[model samples]
Target: MNCKSLQPAAKKCVNEDCELHEKGFAKYFCNICNLFDDRPRPIFHCPYCNTCRMGLGLGIDFRHCMRCNACVSLADKDHRCIPQKLQGSCPICHDTLFNSTEPLKGLRCGHVMHLSCYNQYCRGQNYTCPLCMRCMEDMSDYFSLLDQAVRMQAMPAAYQNTICNIYCQDCEKTGECRYHFVGLKCTQCASYNTREMGRYEQLAAFPN
Candidate 1:
């Protein structure tokens, strides 16, 4: 559409409802989408996405992942299947991640986290999901290290026979095992984040 023709000498249009009457095509604008074009080339807006997108002559082929609650490449529909609903804060940063403006990094276990938060986490030594104990990506080296540690180390004589109740974060199972300085190991999944429970306290999964 010829936006210049819409801008009268009075810097307004006869149609008061038209947004261009107030601001006529500032630099590069799309009358159809009613947004400033950020790219050097023309862009189109997907009503479903409610955001601008880029494409060649054919048009962008992005698809929204309902589970992820975000737009993804058309070819990448088979993402890690998260059975639960997408809601609440990020497991890593404790910030609202669902329906957030920031891009997300989906894990194989079906949980989604901020891309920036994930990058920052990768800078550390560990490589496991913060919410679940499942490995976020390939951690064969880390797993091997843990295996060697478990094999080479032994519990102290004092705590060697003391039985303790524990809960597994990954498998959501409970079992009893001997305690050690390293950590309480879950008999189910071998995750060390298990918490010791008192005789009165019933076994329960940690709050998500």
Candidate 2:
């Protein structure tokens, strides 16, 4: 079997007579670099990561983040830094993230997860990071729509003037807002992704 033809293939060589047929042909094989290589892009061994990675070589298309202990794309150079963010598994699927072959995505909260998992998670209407409970993307437009909806529907008379102590997951702040069955808006960031802590009281109860 011609080894050149299998240079770009990731599957094992099927030539029955070939000695290495069972071993297969790896496009990114580097005998001197590492024993096993499965990365999609051009393979380069990262000393800090102690494994093979796909990129234009370190310091070119990627850089090793000491804090995260992983190689990150140059495009994410200015991303929010989280301590040992890549050391954990994907929050959605619980798959290892450190050496995963799948594409990784960085959340706004500085958490990391598999790109595919992130897509599936978002399709479920979950917009927050699983670990931090913070918004994964800009939710201002969605929150604005919720604001309009809240304004259009008045609360029932029994619950009117009632307030709730809430915690804003996006801004990580605590404040009070008028209780609504739809959602509670944060007083600080105007975000509706809040959790009700407890009821404040009806303003009419202490009327002047």
Candidate 3:
């Protein structure tokens, strides 16, 4: 496409009514209006089409939702708290969310919390998830996963071995143990602490 030929996807000849609206290929300026939809409406409840394409314009950069498994098309510091359909008290304060301040913040574990509660939960030591315990660096990743975790997953099998199983120092139970080298998920014999990890030691396999 050429830079001289572009328009709103909603108006162009592109597949969805606007192929000419190919981003960057054209000015993306409305001919008569001579301005972009600065608000870039998500087209939710479009009376013209009588359809709601809420997620159509969303991109990877869209902020992750502080509560549910969705994304917010805004930045963390600028996130707007809105009524969410998901049900749960603020994870940090355990306060009812029906009328309380919305938890417009998120944890890597997907737990939702109000910004104030999140800070207080960490006791000013440095706020993070009570469950994941992942330290918060910048406000940006407050709702996203750490990059390193994903990088490790890309390693080969040699990097996928379980070194040992963790156990309670005194309980002598494998329930609390984690096989870091092998894997994280515990078999039916036990439940790995998804929210928490425990100490471990090498042990022989049990007889089937």
Candidate 4:
């Protein structure tokens, strides 16, 4: 067969001897970069955010890419589709319930769906949990916000742009992980700096 006619085989990226996992989009990139490839060649990290994610071996029953059109990034409520600012459509299913000004719940996973629509979806799939399908986890956290007459602590508008955050030196998770802003500190002092963007982090820890 001609070189162009032959399709590349699906090879597992790890040593699990399984076929579910495969190389991410790029094949020339390394799994990690820590004094590994400094010779002057360019490195490809990830598609969305390049970080030289190489040598990051895969494991059985694990996935790195799901092509999820998560609801967290949208055209409303910082594109997060908060129930109060849902103004877009679901990229995955293209639901039209997002274009509303009233309280409309969009999934935290970037799926803009009506609260009722999601409930109906769950009801049909033998009540399968919406996220990850690993059985529903306790979700009283997000729902409690919907309860009226709930006197929640108020965040000053000054902190609307604030991004309270932390950077764990261990695991380098704080800097590497996206949610590191939860416990971030003041760059000028030892006090907890609620200033994300070092200027606008509006949320405090939800439960504590």
Q: Pick the candidate with the highest lDDT.
A: 2
| Candidate 4 overall lDDT versus native | 0.35
Which candidate model has the greater TM-score, 3 or 4?
Answer: 3
TM-score of each: 0.57, 0.78, 0.30, 0.20
Model 3: residues with Cα > 4 Å off, grouped in runs: 1-71, 74-85, 98-103, 124-128, 131-164, 167-208
User: Candidates ranked by lDDT, best first?
Assistant: 2, 1, 3, 4
The digit string of per-residue lDDT tens for model 1 on 1-208 reads 3443444334245566667667654545545555565347644555555555553312356665565555555655557656443466787788876446577787767777888999998899656788776667754465467657766888665545566777766567888766555556677665665667732322443221
lDDT of 1: 0.61
Q: RMSD in angstroms, all models?
A: 8.4, 6.0, 16.0, 21.2
Which digits, one per residue and each the tens of the lDDT, describe model 2 over residues 1-208? 4643444333455566665577655656655453555546587888888887777788788888898788888887558888888778888889998889899999988998899998999899899888989989889999889888888998888788788889999889998878889899888988887899999667565221
Better of 1 and 3 by lDDT: 1
Off by over 4 Å in 4: 1-88, 91-93, 101-103, 108-110, 126-208
> What TM value does model 1 have?
0.57
Stretches of model 1 off by over 4 angstroms after superposition: 1-33, 38-47, 53-62, 74-78, 81-101, 121-135, 138-140, 198-208
By TM-score, how accurate is candidate 4? 0.20
